[model samples]
Target chain A: MLEQFGNFLVHGLVTGSMYAAVALGLTLTYGILGILNFAHGEMLMVGAYIAFVLTSRLGVNFLVAAVISMLAVGLLGWVIERTTFRFARHEHLNGLVISLGLVAILQNIALAIWGADPLSIPPPLPRTLEVWGIRIGEQRLLAFGLTVGLIILFSLFLKRTRLGKGIRATAQNAHVAATLGIRTERVVAVTFSLAAALAGLVGALIATIYTITPFMGGLPAMKGFVVMILGGLGSVGGSILAGFLVGVVESFGGGMISSIFKDGFGFVALILILIFRPWGLFGQRPEREDV
Target chain B: MARRSWQALPLVGLLAAGVLYPRLLPGDYFLHLGIVVSLYIILTSSLNLIMGITGQFAIAHAAFYGVGAYGSILLVTRLGVPYWWAWAAGILLAGIAALIIGASTLHLKGAYLAICTFAFSELFRLLLDNWISLTNGANGIIIRFVPPPIGIPGLFRFDLGSRRSYYYLMFTFALVTVWFVRRLARSDLGRVLGAIRQDETLALTAGFDTRRYKLLAFTVGSMYAGLAGATYAPYLSYIAPDLFDVNETIYIMMIMMIGGIRSIWGPVWGSILLVSLPQALDITPLLRMIAYGLVLILVMIRMPDGLAGFLDRLVSRLRPGGTWFGEKA
Candidate 1:
């Protein structure tokens, strides 16, 4: 029984890291810009597709393909923001409508290119090790390691770098940040690219674990939003904590309850949070209430 | 009232056109299209009540539409409830849902409310998808008989057997919904909603009861959606999860945005043109969606008021000396 529980723990940790990786970008974007990118997961989809194309069609090395896909998706994210979001950033409703439209546009473009079939790559690491009756696969370990590493790197970047400081300031108060000559637009654009790159990197990492399809982005994207909400929108620590918590809950829910309803838990939590705490788990309450 | 009667000439003409449409065009396909158009008219107009007029950004519309369709249809099918009574059940369930949901989430502004409602709708959709014992688990429920109209014996037995007749039935409801919304637009509540949309803080300061108005809009809007879905189940004779999905909600949003959020005719005309355009042009599904996305972006960026706004401008430009039927523009 102890061994079985250990296996569940390991499984949950693996899944949790991946969820955090995908959600990190989402929460950051929402926190800073006050705009939710509905098409954010499609960034993941685009990255995976690019990696698949490079490795499968063009015969590039898998590791190199991963890097290329991340950068490419980052560039795509930048272009999308510049074209669609830049003009409408101030108007929240317009930003939402534009983002929704972009979701449709990106999903369609991916569908047109990749079709609807599921795709996958051979695992980058083909070895498995047993740790106390809990077998560990190289692919899972690699995904977990990279996610943790990137998250740490991101936190450090926010802590030390000038641009990162600028992003944090903008998230706290875009108007004040601009008033201080922070170049808020550039910070926003950079933030979008960084978030997009993280999502893209995660897409490539997870492609080896799950089936890579044009529509693979939707569920993860929804879950990413869920994690962000759970963690409290814009709370980096909250996102990570909620990501792992969700993964464990999902792992147990799938193992103990029913797998079919596993997807529903996060959404259920989202509704409850909205009703009970619209601000989120770690978010600050609005200083002023209109009604 | 007499001056208002003269001002209502265009609306009367529209009502007459809707009434005469089936008679003039006797084609089954056209009549079928009419029912479809009416269904969208209901969807867009109700959505307008919340999103367009109230300025609440929400994405739970199709879920409400689904609840209405499933609620009424299940009553009629599973429990053998009377068809008309099932509609009441559906509308009631939808209104209750909106009331409970709106009350819970109304305090959250903008995307927070949107995400909350969206998640709630997803919950409803999942229940419909998984509760196989009840909802048939995505296989969906199919009903063969058209819902007969409810009335006293021998006084009226409505003919729902024919699509043309169904078109008239839809037309009557559609006309009524439009007129109802029009009346609401010019009423005290409508003005308050507009005020809330413009500036919720100021509206609150003015003691407008913003939450109550928002809740009212959300509940009434949901009821309209349920009514549309109840009408739709009979016309199509089948409904799967596909009929009421986020995509459907976005499509409705597109229709409302394209037509004119603030105008009654905007959604009506938008639905008419969009609903018939693909049928007329035979555009492929991918290209059609691309066009949808493109139009949404273009409209938001360039034409803030949508087609109605553009038309208002054109009419005003042409006849600077004359009032355009007491239109808001």
Candidate 2:
């Protein structure tokens, strides 16, 4: 029983870090842009597929391919922003709808290219470490370690760097940021890019743990959005915490109950949390709560 | 009176087209496509009332639809209930579910309400999947024949045992749904709902029961969706979670947006165009979804009011001060 408990904890944290990585991006984008990217998961899917192609077709090193995937998807995000979301910056409804459109388009394109089958690459480290009789995969450890490191680096970038501060300032008040000579458009675009990059990075890492598929991003995307809300839309720390919470809930709930309840359980917890705390665990009251 | 008759001229044309569609094509495939279009029109027009006219972005319409389809199908297969009675029961269950979901979540604001309803929808889908004893899990339930028991033995038993019969039934329901929505749009209730949709605070300030109206719109809209689903079960003869999942919900939203959300004819036009586009162009499934996404994004960005709205403007511009085909005043 104790061994199983430890195993579940280990699995949950690894899962939680993946959620956190994407949720961090989602929250940052929402904080700055006031729009949730419904197609964030497709970005993850695209990222994973890119990494897969780079490694298999071009024989790029796995880690190097992951990095390239991150950068490529981030650049793709910038293009998407300019084409689809620049005009829709102020229209939250349009942003949501457009994001969904992007999801459909991306998913269909991926399906066409890859077909509806799951694919996987051999793990970079293919070793398992047994700590106190609880076995953990090296791939999972590497993925979690990278996710945490990047998240910390991201937080610092948002705090200490000039561009990062510009982003936070814009997020705080776009009107004031614009008045203070900060190009809010650049901030929004950069944040969206970073978010997409983070999603891609997580996607590449997650592919190490599970098989990759064109449709794999949908569940994680839903969970990541739920985590964003659970942690509070704009709170980075809250999102991280909530990501773990979701992972733990899903892991333990699926272990104890039926596997089908994994996603369902996470949403149930979200609904309960919402009922009691509409603002979310870490979210501040949005200025316009009427809608 | 003559002016009023002229006002409904466009709708008359629409009615003629709808009635003549099966006759014009007459092939089984075309008739099947017509049934699918009719089903979508019934589904999305109700969605229009909740999201378009009432301004509530509830995404749980598909869940209610699932309830209707599953409920009616279960009653027929499990308990030997007649098809007509099962449909009523299914619609009632969906309405009740809507009432509960709407009452609890209606007071929340836009995105919050949307997510909350989404949660509800997801939860229902989950239950439908897990409750295998009742829902048959993800395998889904299949009803080979509709078994249209007229309830009166001697009143002439109409056998809905073929695709053609199912098509006619769906066509009739589609017409009824369109007619009902048109009447609702012109009624005081629709006007009040529209006002509330415009600004709930202002609507309430003007001494309106905003919550009641919103709930009414939600319940009625859900019932309409339920009716569509219940009718759809025997038409497809197969019911599964995929048919009523989040994807389906969003697809319904897409139809409403593409067809034009604010008008009754929007769903019909949207459904017809979208359902037939792949067939017409021989587009691959992947290419079709990509096109759908493009159209939806373009419409939302350039013409938030939709294709129906575009046509309404064109007609009004063509005939200034005239209610061409009963454009909403």
Candidate 3:
């Protein structure tokens, strides 16, 4: 039991990092746009499929495939933003409908292109590392290490750079940011592309850990939503923390209880938090518009 | 006075059509489809009372429906309670559950309320799936025997055994539900809910208890769903957790949106079109699901106001400020 507990924690951190990496984009979009991108999961699914195609068809290394996938998904996000989400009519409900429609379209496209069967991505490194009686797979360690490095880089980018500050400023108050000479549109566009890139990276990594399937994004997207709400809708820091927290809870909980309950935990936590806090763990009361 | 009578004519005609249509339609399959549509019409309209009218999104609507179904099914099968009493018991239990959930969560507005309600539905589903000793753990309890006779007692036994009778029963119930909502909409409570939906802070300043009204709408809407479920359990004769899923909630919202939200008969018209469309297609299962997804997306993108609202506007255009059924008295 002690050894398994140790194992659960190790596994949790790896899985949790991937979750945080992708869900961070969800946090940014929700904070700035206030629209739950229901297709966010499908974006990840697209990325994974891209990686699968790159490696299997082109015989590229997994890392190179991931980079290619990220660029492709980033381009897709740019296109989606310009075409679908750019229109400002009843944004929230309209975004929901459009994103949902996109989910179906993407899933069907994937089905047409790759079929419904699952595909696997071979690990970039074939070796495993053992330290202090802990067995760690090389691919998982690389994912974990990459995620931590990215988080640090992202934090630095957000804090130090002018573009990063502009994005943050827009998230805080788009009108004020625009008035202060920061182009809110550019900031929003950049944030959205960055988010898509992060989702693509996580998608590629996840494909290495698990099989790449068209339907894979649905569960993860729903779980990420639960995590985002729990951590507070727009708080990147909170999302990072809560992502790991959810992973640990799910890992240990699944190990203890049934696996079906794992998916239920994020939502359960969300409801409990909303009941008690309503503002979320780190969220502020959004200025009211209508009801 | 003549114009007012004209407005009444459509309502009267619709009720008359609803009553007579079952007899006019041939084949049991279409009748069965009619029953499902009517059931959804009730469900979607009841959901509209909370989401559309009150502006409080309650995705847990189906959870209340499931509670009603499970509550009555358990009472009838396990406790040996008669069907009539069991049905009432299920509705009451569901109503109470809704009341509690509403009181706790309805204070939240916007997406927060939606998230909370969604969580409750998920919780209910988990409990239903896990609680093996009671729900038989996904196997589902099959209701075997007919309850003791009701209505005409010995001579006119309530035979749930047949589909045709069930169809008429569901259609009549749906009509009564529409009438009830019509009355509610015209009431002062409806006005208050509308005000709250428009502006809660302003409504509070206007001396309206926005919280109370929101909760009231939630509970009442859920009660109607529960009642629908109570009757529905006997129709389906089986209860499962999937009936109360998030997708079902989304489907209800889509129907209401398509039907021209805030319109009284919008859900009924929308349900008739959307529900019957795929069944009429009669395609393979995988292609059918794909088709369903496409249909929903196309409707959302191109026809947001839905079929009924479009027709209503078209008729108005041709007639020039005239009513479809007749002019208001």
Alpha-carbon lDDT of model 3: 0.78
- Choose the strongest candidate by DockQ: 1
DockQ, each predicted model: 0.53, 0.50, 0.40
Error of 3 at B322 (Å): 6.4
In candidate 1, which residue ranges exceed 4 Å CA deviation?
A: A288-290, B23-26, B150-158, B319-329
Expressed as tens digits, the lDDT of each residue in A32-85 for candidate 2 is 877767889988999999988988879899999999999999998898887888
Candidate closest to the true structure, highest lDDT: 2
Rounded to one decimal, what is candidate 3's iRMSD?
3.4
Listed per prediction, chain B TM-scores read 0.93, 0.92, 0.92
Q: Comparing 1 and 2 by DockQ, which wins?
A: 1
Q: Which regions in candidate 3 have their CA more than 4 angstroms from the true location?
A: A1-5, A88-90, A125-130, A133-135, A155-163, A172-190, A256-260, A286-291, B1-7, B143-158, B281-295, B319-329
Clashing pairs in 3: B2-B329, B3-B328, B3-B329, B4-B328, B4-B329, B5-B329
Q: Return the clash pairs for model 2, or none.
A: A291-B109, A291-B110
- Tens digits of per-residue lDDT for model 1, B1-329: 99888867767987899988888877998898898888899899889888878888877899888888999999998999999999889989989888988888788776667667777777777788899999897898888877886445876545888776688778777887787787887899899999998999999899888989999998998899988888789888888886787768878987887777767778887788778877775588887777777777877777666677777777788877443422431
CA lDDT, candidate 2, residue B65: 91
lDDT of each: 0.82, 0.84, 0.78
Candidates ranked, most accurate by DockQ first: 1, 2, 3
**What proportion of the true contacts does each candidate reproduce?**
0.59, 0.51, 0.29
In model 1, the Cα lDDT at residue A259 comes to 79
